[model samples]
Target chain A: MLLSNLELVPGRRVVKHLGLVQGSTVRAKHVGKDLFAGLKNIIGGELKAYTELLKESREEAVERMVKQAESAGANAVLNIRFATSSITQGAAEILAYGTAVTLE
Target chain B: MDLILQNFDLLLFAVLFITGYVAGRWNERRHYASIRKREDEFAGILVFTNRFPPPSTTRVATVLVSGSAVISEDFFKGVVAGLYSFFGGRIRSYESLLDRARREAVLRMKEQARAQGAGMIINVKFQTFAIGGRRASSVKGVEMLAYGTALSPVGA
Candidate 1:
């Protein structure tokens, strides 16, 4: 399915609008990664563990969103956006939301 | 008990402060150098607003690109930040932390765009997530995300 933040697809015409759909997931860091991050913190560059954590979280969120759109009988999702919130110590929530649509 | 406790805490802070200053400084310099170099190389690709589409493009594809960076605050910066808060002024140490994370995210997005053969990226936006923060777990770090829709000529 096509996903975009833009309201309209460039080459396709919007045939129908299927309302808003969303998917979200929460994740946390483990002891191993925590130790790694602690060591990396001193060096002050990109933390790969956390980067992978967030990336996986975002992907899962988007995957769920796609599932929702598919079940809704929609061919595309538009105006998709993401949000993150700290749910607890070591854990974060990632949310992906968008309007489901049918385009031709 | 009180005297021993005090000494131990000071010792811990001293170690952390020195480690943070040295390692953080080195990392910052290295990242800045890399970011600058890559930005220059990727300058030709277009990154802009989503309001307009390239006129010559026959077919358009929308792609999602994002970069994530987690920066941890060192013991030294933490102490300074704690004290600096009372004065209500900018904490310079945290500034570079945030800067590095943001730049790293943007560069990742640009790299993704390049890999997809996209000439430009539009609707670029940034999102910041505190991994371990106040009211949550005590891990001091941030996750910066830069994402956008990449546009490339489909027919070409």
Candidate 2:
């Protein structure tokens, strides 16, 4: 599977529109991490907890998006994009979407 | 009685510190694990775009949350209080969390677009909400959403 944000790939040629594809995931980190993050606040620095979190969430969403594209039999996906929503205090939703197309 | 109160404070602080440390470590571990798993999943996929898509084009794709995520009440309250203590003033930890979530989501989407061979993404959008109950003084979980489209070149 291929994914991109631009409508067209730099060198490849799109042959057909494979239709729309998307992927999403809902995630919740353990509370114990939150407690450590709170302590980090006192020391003052980077919020490693949240950094790790967003990273993981982003990967999951991308994976799902790729799966969707593959299922659609798309040779590539163009103009990929991501969206996130907070479902609750500990949980978040990550979503990825793009246009599935065939490449010549 | 004074001694007892002092001891209680000490115990509370210890608990808070330990909890915080544990939470941070656990969060880090989970993050690494998730990344590894996703990388394995994406190993076969290709990406093309590295930046945001240019404006002035119709969106060809979109993604949505379509669900809910909840933070533990205890964790939410602790984060709020921790932020207050660190900042020494009113701070919107929840809002910050929402904003971070949105940004991260968009970044991931861009990554996906790049993998798929797109030059840009557009039509980005966001939404947020709090699940159930009235607004309380303590921190509560919030839901944030981000969406957009990945665009490839016209001919390709």
Candidate 3:
């Protein structure tokens, strides 16, 4: 599906407005990744494990939003936006939302 | 018992130094290489901007593309950090941690846009969060998020 944060597609025309669609997910860091993070703490560098956790969460949230848009019969999702928050010590929540529209 | 007690500090330093020099350095080099490779490969795809429509594209559709990275500090850095703390100067070890996180996040976002066949990215922004953030005596991790609107050309 075509996704964008723009209200309009420059070359295409929006023929139908399917309204809003959204998807969200909550995730917790795993022990293995946390262990790796702990090890890295001794040397000080990027935590690949936690990064993967958030990345996966984002994709999952977006995937759900896409599913919502598809159910609304939208060929594209527009004005896409994301929000993230640390819900607790080891967990986080990611939310993705957009307007679903049919373009011609 | 006396011998062991006398060399405890020495043994601790040796252990930290050995592990930090080997694993920490190895991971950093490998990660840098990976980041360099991906950045070069996606150079054309990233039209990083903060303006909408990403002028001069067919603009078939737009989607939000994002990447995130979280990294921790190694023990070797801690040793130097201790020195820097006393000298009252920049803590250089933490700089690379944040730098790598940002670069990695942006690179991932580009990869996402590429997967969707986006021709351009615009209105890019970054979000950062620290979990148990930078304190003198604790393990810390940071999250860097790179996001933007990805635009694809029409009929492509």
Candidate 4:
């Protein structure tokens, strides 16, 4: 399935709108990674562990959203957007949502 | 020995301050240099915030592309920000942090588009947020994500 974060695909027309589809997941940092991050606070730089973790979470959310679109008989997901919220001290939720549609 | 024992906390604070100052400065300089060089290298690819791609006669395929970066504030920067908060003025140190995060995110998105043989990205959107910043005095970090649709000719 194709994905675009725009209202309409440039060269294609929407044949059917399958309404909104969304996926979300919540994750907490590993104890070891959190320990390393604490030390990194002293001499700050990129947080590779957290970055990778969040990236994976986001990809999973997108994958689930794609699955929903596929099940709905949609060929594409449009106007895709992402949201993130910290659930607690070490946990966060990543969400991916978009309008599912069939293109012609 | 008595003096050292009594001032152990002070000594550790001093050491952490010095290390943070020196290491954070060096890291910032190196990251800025790398960012500049890579930006120049990626100048050939076009990025835009327009909602729609330009009209094209040839068949083109479009796909979503995204990039994200997370950076933490050093002890020195956090201390500086604390001081700035007292004065009720702009926190200059954080400006650089946010700038770096945004630039890095955009660069990564461009890299992905390049890998996909896409010539341009449109409708680019950016999202920025603090990671695990709820607790007081916790190590604070900012995350920036850049996402958009990349357009490339169907064959190439």
Query: Using TM-score as the measure, which candidate wins?
Result: 4
lDDT (tens digit, per residue) of candidate 3 on A7-102: 776778899999999999999877777676776787766766677777788889999999999989999998777888877767778898989999
lDDT of 2 by residue, B12-97 (tens): 76776666556644653464465466556544432222344334544334222111222222343355656787778755644444
lDDT of 4 by residue, B44-135 (tens): 88999999887652677898999999998888998899889888899988999999999999999999999999989999999997986757
Candidate 1: Cα lDDT at A55: 92
Worst 10 residues of 2 chain B by lDDT: B62-71
lDDT per model vs. reference: 0.82, 0.55, 0.79, 0.91
**What are the iRMS values of all candidates?**
1.9, 9.6, 3.0, 1.0
The DockQ values of the predictions, listed in order, are 0.63, 0.06, 0.45, 0.82
lDDT of 1 at A46: 70
Task: Name the top DockQ candidate.
Answer: 4
Model 2 alpha-carbon drift over 4 Å, by segment: B1-156
lDDT of 1 by residue, B49-149 (tens): 65556666678888777667777766566667778988989999788879888887888888898998988888887898876666423667788888778
Question: Which has the higher DockQ value, candidate number 1 or candidate number 3?
Answer: 1
Whole-structure CA lDDT of model 2:
0.55
Each prediction's TM-score versus the true structure = 0.91, 0.47, 0.74, 0.97
